[model samples]
Target: MQAPINIALVGNPNSGKSSLFNALTGLNQKVSNFPGVTVDKKTGTAQIVPGLTANIIDLPGTYSLYPKSADEYVTYDVLINPDNADIPDLIIIVADASNLKRNLLFCSQIIDLKIPVIIGLTMMDIARKKGVEIDLDGLERELGVPVVSINPRKSKGVAELKKIIDLAARGNYSAAPRDFINNGALAKPVTDEIKKAVPGKSDYAALHIAVNADELHFLNIPQKAAIKQTLQTHQFNKTKVQAEEIMQRYNRIKHIMKSTVVETDPLQKQLRSEKIDDLLLHRFWGYVILLVVMFLLFQSIFWLASYPMDWIEGGFGQLSGWLTSVLPDNKITDVFVNGILAGISGFAVFIPQIMILFGLITILEDTGYMARISFLTDRLMRQVGLNGKSVMPLISGVACAVPAIMATRTIENKKERLITILVTPLMSCSARLPIYTMMIALVIPDRRIFGILGLQGLIMMGLYLLGFFMAIFIAAIMKLFVKIREKSYFIMELPVYRAPRWKNVGTTMVEKAKIFVTDAGKVIVVISVILWFLASYGPSSRMQPLHDKYEKMIAAVPADSPAADSLDKAFRSEKLSHSYAGILGHAIEPAIRPLGFDWKIGIALITSFAAREVFVGTMATLYSVGENPDDNNATLREKMAAAKWPDGRPVYTLAAGLSLMIFYSFAMQCMSTLAIVKRETKSWKMPLIQLVYMTALAYICSLIIFNIFK
Candidate 1:
C-alpha cells in the first residue's frame, strides 16, 4: 500500500491551528505520544481529494523555528530531522490574519525550509473587525505560496483549503519562489560549513543545523562533532546570527505587508480585546469573578448532573436486578451481576459529572477566558517561583496528571517545572470526582446556605480549592529547596474573547466521557471482578466450617421463618469476614483505623492504588459480594449508607466519610500517575519520592482530620 501524504498543520499558540485541524479531520483524529517523546501527537486522516487521504500531523503550536521549550523542540525536530517519519510532503501553515506580522515570522521561517507550503489564513473575521484587511492574491504573489482564507470555527473556506491541498498533492502548487531571508548571509561561515557537512538541506535548514546541531537528537556523533568543530573554528555568534535573520525577515515582511495587507495603527484605538481585558483582567475584580465562576462551576456539577447520575444509578440497579432474576443462580451469574455490572455502573454513573466538567472547561477555553485566567493567576503563581506558564499545566492537572505532567515540558525553567510536576498531583483530577461526590453526598446535608449556595456544592468546591491551595503550598515549600535559580518571565498572548463553540464543547464532553468509561473503566472492571472473587470465596478451612454450622442451624428452623433468614445473613457476613479480600483489608485495617477506614474501605484503598476511580468500583464490588441484587434494589449509595461496625456504629458517619475524602484528596495512590511521573522526570527517584511524601502527607492529614471530627 502506498503511504498517504504526510501533512503538518503548524502555527503559533491560539492561532486557530487546532480549529483548522478539527475542521479538516472532524471526528477522524486520535491523540498519542510522539515516538521517542512523551509529547502528545494529534494525527488524523483528511481526504484531500477523492480517494486520496493525507495523514495530518498537527505539530505543537510554536512561535518560531528557534526552539525553547520541549514542545517547540519536538516541532523543530520533526521539521529539521531529515530522516524523521513524520516529515511532511505538504505543510499547511495556519496563520492568524489578526496577527499577520508576527504570524508571518514563523511562516517565513518554514517557507525558507523550501517545502511545499500553503498558508491558511484564519481569524479573518477578527482581523476585519480590528480594521485589518488582507488581499489573498497579493499575499500569494509575495509569499510565493497559495494563501487561502479560512474561518475554521464556522467551517468556512475549508473546502477551498482542501481543494488547494489537492492541487499541491498533484504537484500543481508552487513552492516558495525565493528565500524568505538571505539565510547564507546571516552566518556565511557556519551555514556554508553546515551545508557541506549535512548535504542536500536548504540553506536555512543548514543554518538551523549550525545553531541547533548540538541539541538536535537526529544528528549522529560524527555529524555533531563536525558541526561543533566548524562552529568553533568560525567563532559563530549564534545570538547575532539569529537576530540578523529575524531583522532581515521582518524588513522583507514590511515591504510584503505594504502590498498585501492593511491594518489600523495601534495608537489610534485599542482593539476590542484590550478593552474587554480592562475589566476581565482587573486584579481584584478578576479574582472575584474567578471565584464566582468556580462557585458556579462546582454548583453545576451537582445541579446539572444530579438527574442524569440518578437515572444512570437507577438504570444499573434495574439491570443488576433483571440479570439476577433472569440468569440462573450460579457463580457466572454472580460475577456478571455483582462484579462486572456493579463495576461498570460505578464509573458509569459519574459520566454526567465528567461530561459537564469537561464541557464547561471547554467553554472557558473556547471563549479565551482560560488564557486570561493564566494571566490573572500569574501573580499567585510567581509567589511560588513559577510564572504564568505553570498555570496551564496546573489547570490541566484538574483533568489528569499524566498529560498534565507531560505539559510541564512547556515550562522552560527546570526548577519551576520540576516543582510544578511534583505538586500537580495535588490538584484533584476528575478521577477523584466520583469519590468526592459520593462522599460529599453521604456526609454533607442536601441543604443550602443563605438559601442560595447548596452545602453539598460548597463542600465540593472547597475540595477543589483545597487541592489547588495544597498544590500551591507544596510548590512554595519546594521552591525553597529546588535551589536552581533562573530568571522567569510570563510572556503570553491573550487571544480575543469569542463566543463558545457549542459543537466543540459537545465534542469535548463526549470525548472525555468516553475516555473515563473506556480507559478508567477497563481497570475498574478487572479490579472489581478480582475483588468480588476474593470477597466471595475464602480459605476452605475457615469458610466451610462456618457454612456447615449455619446450614445445620438453618435446617433445624422453619425454612421461611425470620430465624432461617437471619442465619443466612449471619453465614454470608461470616463468609465475607474470612474471605481473601477481607484478610487483606483486615491486615491493613490496624494501620488505617485511626483514619476512620474499616476493612471494606481498607480494601478499596488497596485496589484504588491502581487508579483513583477504581475506588468507586471497589466499593460497589465489596458491598455487593454476598448481597442479592434482585432482593435489594437499593442504590450503591444506600447500601454504603447502611454499613456498620460490629459494635453497631454506622460506618458512613460524617466524621468517617469526611476523613476518607480527606485521605483520598491527599493520597498519591494512582500507580499510573506514579509511572507517568517516572516517565516525565525520566527517573524512578522523583516519583518514588513523590509517592512517599504524598502518602505520608495523606496519612498525617487524614489522621488529624479524623481525630478532629471524631
Candidate 2:
C-alpha cells in the first residue's frame, strides 16, 4: 500500500501552471475556498501511473515567495509554513522557458526551501519562436535538479514528467544538491534566530519566516513575538537582506544561463504580436475598435441566438399544451402545467443569449484582448480612484457579481478593491440581461439603427454601457467617502495575441449555461409554484361569494356557448384579483404606483427579491394561471401586451417597461451577490449599506423615468 502524496503546481501568473494541472488531472478536479480566505483552491486526484496516485493542488500564482495580496499570500503560506495542511510533499515549479531569467528567480527561491523539487518548464515553443534555444541537459546539470520541458496544451512531456515525479517520490524526495544562493550568510544572526523559531527548516525557509512571520497564519503569538524580538535584537533589515539575496541569485543564474542557453538577439526585430499591438493598443483607434467590438457582440446575441430562442419558446409552449390536455383536470395538473412548466419556459428561453454572452466573453479572454482592455481603461480607472486591476473585476461583473466580487482578490489596493466591490453589481450581470432583453422586446421597436444595427441590440448595448458608466460614477463618489489610503501600482504583461481557444470557449459556454439552468432555474421554479398557489386560491370569504355569482351566471347560459366561455373568463379574472397574491400586490401597489407598476407588477417585484431573473418566471406563472384554458397557447409576450388595467390602459406600456428595466439595473436584488459581498468584505455592514443605497437609487431612477415617459 502506497500513501498518496500532495504535489503542488506553482508558478508566476499565466505561467502555464493551471494548464499543466488540467493536463495531469483531467476531469478529476473540484474547487473549494482556501482555508480562512475566499480565494478558490483547485484540487484534483491524478493517477501518475497505474498504481501511483497523487493529490494535485493548483496554488495561486506569485512572482516570488514574498506576500502581497490576499490570494498571493495563500500561495506563500502553503509553501513556506511547515504545518500547513496543504504544504506540498513535492513541488512542481512551472516556469516559462521564454522568460527564463525572470522565472528562475522564483524557481531558485523555491529550490532553496529544500523541498523535493522538479522544474516543469513550459513555453519552450514560444521561446524558440523568438529565436531562443536551450540545452536541456546543460541546464539540468547547472541547476542540479531535473528539468523537463513540457507543453501542457499539447500534453507533451507529461508521461516523462510523471515518471520523474514517481521516481523522486520513491527515492529520497531530495532537495536541490546545492543552494542557489548562500542564504545563511545573507543575515547570519537573523537567519539563525528564525531557525530556532521554526526549527529544522533550511536557511532560506528560516529567512522567509523572519520576513513574513506577521503575515503567516500558522505562527502563534509566542512564535511571532520571539521572531520579532530576535529581529529587533539583530537589527534585521528585510529590504536590504531581500535585495542582496535577489541580486546574488540573479548573478548565479546569469552564469548558469551563459553555458546552457542561446538567447535571441535584441536587434532581431519585434515579434508578430508586438506588431499587431501597434494598432490594437493605439490610443485613438483602440477605443474605436473596442466600441466596434462591443457593438458587434450585442448584435450577435440577438442575431445568432434569435432562432434558438424561438425554438425553445415554441418547444416549451407545445410541451405545456400537451401536458395540460393529457393530464387529468385538477389542481395538481394546473400547478404542474402553469406553475412548473411556465416557470421553466421563462428562463429556459433565454439560455441562448446567456450562452452567447459568456461565450463571447470567454473568447475575449482567450484571444488576449481582455488584458489590453484593462490597459486601455487604466487611465480612466485612475480617474475614478482605481487602478487597471479593478477593470477585470468590473468587466467580469457582466457575467455574475459573485465571481466579479471574488475577482477583487487580485486588486492589491484595499480602497480600490472595496470600491470595486461596491460598484461592481452596477454592471449589468447576465441575470439582468434577461430583464433587459424582455423589456427591450416589450417596449423598444424592432428596427435597424444606421441601416444595419438592430434597434433591440442597440438598446441592449445602451443598458450595458449605462451600467458600466454608472459603476464608474458610483466608484468616484465612494472614493471620496471611503478614506482608506494605500499606495498601489498596476503592472500588466500583455500576452502575445493568439487565436481564440475554441475548445475552452465551448466548455465555458456549456458550463455557464448549465449554471444558469441549475442555479437560476431552481429559484425561478420555487417562486413560480408559490406564486401559482397564491394567485390560484383566495380566502373562503372572498372566494365563496364570487363562486356563487359565477355559478348562477354559468347556469343562465349553455356550457359550450361563447357567452358561457366569456362568463368563465370573467370569473377567473375576478377570482385572481381577489386572491391572496393579488391582495398582497395591492397592499404594496400605492408605493410603486408612481413608477407605473400595478398590483401584478408589484407581485413580481416582491416575489423576485430572491433573484432578479426570477422576475421572468414570476410573470410567466402569474399570467398563465388566470388565462382561459383554451387560450393557453398564447405566448407570454402576447398575453402581457394584451393585458389591461381596470381603466383599460396597458399594464406593460413603454413607460412601465422602461421603469422596470431601470429598477432592475440599480437594485441589489440578488441575495447571492449580497452574500458574496459580505464574505469578501467580511462585514454585513458594507453589504447592508450597499443594499440600502442601491435600492433607494433604483426607486428614484424608476420614478423619474416613469414620470418622463408617462
Query: 1-710 in candidate 1: lDDT tens per residue?
Result: 34589999999999999998999898899999889889999999987778679999999999999989888988998898988989999999999998899999999999999999999999988888778878999998888899999999999999999898888888898578798878878888788888888888889999888877778888888889999999999998889888888999999999998988877654436767889888888978888888889899999999999999999999888888787778898989888888898899999999999999999999999999988888998999999888788999889988998899999999888888888889999999999999999999888899988999899988998988999999999988887888757898999998888898898899999999889888999999999999989999889998889888888898899988888778777777788889999888889999999888999999899889999999999999887885645354678999998888999999988889889988888899898889998988889999998999899999999899888988
Off by more than 4 A, model 2: none
Candidate 2 lDDT, 1-710, residue by residue in tens: 47889999999887889879988998788888988888989999999987789999999988888878888888988988778899898999999988899999999999999989999999888788788888999988888788999988788999999999999889854888788889999998988888887788899988988887777777889889999999999988999999999899989999988999987664545778888799988989999999889989998998888899888887877787788888899999999989999999999999999999999998898778988988999999989898899999999898898888998998878888999999999999899988888888888898986898888888788888888999999988998998757877889978767777676678778878988999999989998999899999999999999999999999999999999999998998998899999889889999999999988988988877788899999989988998987767777887888899889998889999999999999999889899999999889998999999999989999999999999
Model 1 / residue 618 / CA error / Å: 0.9
* Backbone clash total, candidate 2: 0
Number of clashes recorded per candidate? 0, 0
Residue 314, model 2, lDDT: 79
The segments of candidate 1 whose C-alpha lies over 4 angstroms from its true place after superposition are: 1-3, 264-268, 628-630
Error of 1 at 323 (Å): 2.5
Least accurate 10 contiguous residues by lDDT in model 1:
625-634
